[model samples]
Target: MSVGKLPVIDLTPMRAGDEFHKRALGDALREACVHTGFFYVAGHGVPQALIDRVFAASKAFFDQPMADKRKVDKALSAANRGYEFLGGQTLEPGAPPDLKEGFYIGEELAEDDPRVLAGAFNMGPNQWPAGVPDFAPVMMEYYGALLELSREIMAALALSLELPEDYFEAFCTEPLATLRLLHYPPQPAQPLPGEKGCGAHTDFGGVTILLLDDKPGLQVWDALNERWLDAQPIPGTFVVNLGDMIARWTNDRYRSTLHRVINTSGAERYSVPFFYSGAPQHEVRCLPGCLGEGEQPKYAPVTVEGHLREMYRRTYV
Candidate 1:
């Protein structure tokens, strides 16, 4: 029961059609959520070839000159797409800017889409880099695939919470998902005081599926022990963690722990983290079984879009 290290959960059982395996997997997921809120997931059906292709495209895109990458600056995109250079944002309030660069992509909506017409935030076209010819295509493919995987995982999570498997379907019809490709350059031997690759903060969405390179830099704060534990990368698997929205939905039964990255690996570190959340218009309320007898709800109902907009305002420069 010691939640010292992140747990590894095989997702194959949940994906399989066996009811027994599904129930078992749900049980394990429930425990992991309550204890650690983070885990390593294997057997997640995404093809390794597809993952590799995306990584390759990410590197190629980041390898471009600063001017080339800046052509699609996120500041120019109303939908929060495009590239963000190092120090453009700070995840942890009052901390120095993050020492990393990243490209953000989301579901590409056309100008005529109803959501776009309504001026919905985060519901418009993504800005593709002209320098990397194959970056857009490869990233789009990965996004479409991961979106489906996220739904499947959500179903499993619903079951773990003692709700019907399809309980979350309504909230996902127009998911506000984001696929971020991040590159952390080799850190200086003596970094400025208070500088970090990514500052300590909890994700603002529902779940994060992270694929990291072998070089170690990510660390999770162990609140139980008041210490930082390395989230070492594992081959052929991804690190999955719950986000603040999920913690709120479950009335704090699950954790949304603080985590950060420090790239002192003496090598450039690349990571792809897909952040999946509910539809912008969906209202997140406390689930039925989350509150114990006579326990008051810890949070008020909030719309996904409103929460995201506020979080973005705080983080972006």
Candidate 2:
């Protein structure tokens, strides 16, 4: 039923535009979401050539001189779009900072865009590193592809919950998604206690679409089993995981599992994660189906932007 602990779902059936098969795909998605909150997506329609190009660009950008990378440091951008040096983020409280350097890209907006004019959180143009001249275009192309795929996955999620297929249409419009390229060096021979490539934390958004390099490091917390399970990288598949907002939306009927990376492969590792957080103004509330007859909502209503700001405050503070 599953590749390992996580399900391997093929989107090809749904891509055929068959209503019957689409609902069948939704059923499988519901199982994976409720059980593991993680899965591998195959036949997602992104060209392998494009995927390869994006990886090449990521490595090239990260391979640039540290001074060059710092020229586009995330601190320099108001919207938090740029390079983040290793150990810059502490995802798990009390643990050592994550040992990964990353670059963030989001919807390319102009200085005069209304969202930018209003000074919305994380709204503005991206700051690209000029050292890797082709990085921006390659990353943007991959971003565009993932955006389309994210919406399709959202629609399928709606069907999974027995909602109208367009239930999340508004949320997908003008989304506050982010595409992050991360590079993790091999783990230290004598690592600090609790140190990891990425600290254990649940994602903050709607859904995350991740492309991983062949080196192993990813681990998903198995709450029921009370152990960490390796999420091995599979060729031709992207790892997909639900985020905290989805758990909030579903009243926790679906999980937002904790996951981290611990690159022990003795080689460099690179991964690209696209966070599909939905629209800034979209209000997230418990779905009717997610609650029992007398169950109360576990969380209060919050807009996407508000939730993200709160999550960022907790992790970055």
Candidate 3:
């Protein structure tokens, strides 16, 4: 069954064990994944109060003086945790730098942790901004909530792919996830050519769960029509999209479509995107049922860490 221009899926059924409902959930997810790689998920159990606190903390932190914000700049940590200045990244090669500032948060590990000692890529203690009192607590709480929700979504994805519900259990263990808070200023009247709040690019991880403010700016590419479709924000729901790893795992059976943002709402826009990249050591190979008879895997196997490192190199180097 088609779910309109962009599907709005209910996760409430996925939380229960009724076979019929589970299968129906899987079917809906499969439709979204195979077609647009985007959907809106409702009935996710995160509290609205906690979501509000997160947004409030984000704005409070961003409103701080530049000197205070720069104290925890991402450059201070090799693990890529902390604040990122506006235009710090260019997601689309050859396009102007992205016109947004962001902050990154990840699992809190101590300096002497084994992972940190081993110099693991993007693995280390998070640097918290000092001035925003509620920033640390609210963000950590929201991160925990999103992390658990992502595992449930991953299970649904496995079911959609005709695999067992726990097919990604190993992959979810000790996953490498990132919670990013972004602020996009209004689009300039005469912006630079190809400039945007974020550039046209596919995400690099397994999945992304994005929370948006009431302003519309997100857009997903409609490859079939060769046009971009606005992804309007809907209250009480989060926009979900697949990433490159899913496409690779399915041998391209599922899309990891290109998307971007442009803050044309004439006001600042704030969003939170949780990137659920599975275990750093998990081996990402083509799934068993993804290939046709006598067809070989299109890409060689790579560990999650290896894939992430390569993607980071391409974008940040």
- Separately for all candidates shown, the number of backbone clashes (residues 3 or more apart, or on different chains) is 0, 0, 0
Q: What TM-score, computed on C-alpha atoms, does each candidate reach?
A: 0.96, 0.97, 0.97
Model 2 global lDDT (CA atoms, 0 to 1): 0.92
Candidate 2 local lDDT, 1-317, one digit each (tens): 11256899888875786888888999999999999999999989999999999999999999999999999999999999999999999888899999999999999999999989999989899998877778888889899999999998998899899999899999999999999999999999999999999999999999999999999899999888688889999999999999999999999999999999999999999999999999999999998699998889999999999999999887667
lDDT for 245 in candidate 2 is 96
lDDT of 2 at 176: 90
Q: Of the pair 1 and 3, which is ahead by TM-score?
A: 3
Q: Please report, in order, the local distance difference test score of every candidate based on alpha carbons.
A: 0.88, 0.92, 0.93
Q: Which wins on lDDT, candidate 1 or candidate 3?
A: 3
| Candidate 2, residue 114: how far the Cα is off, in Å | 1.7
lDDT of 1 by residue, 188-222 (tens): 78887878999999999999999998898988888
lDDT of 1: 0.88
Q: For candidate 3, write residues 213-260 as lDDT tens digits.
A: 999899999888788889999999999999999999899999999999
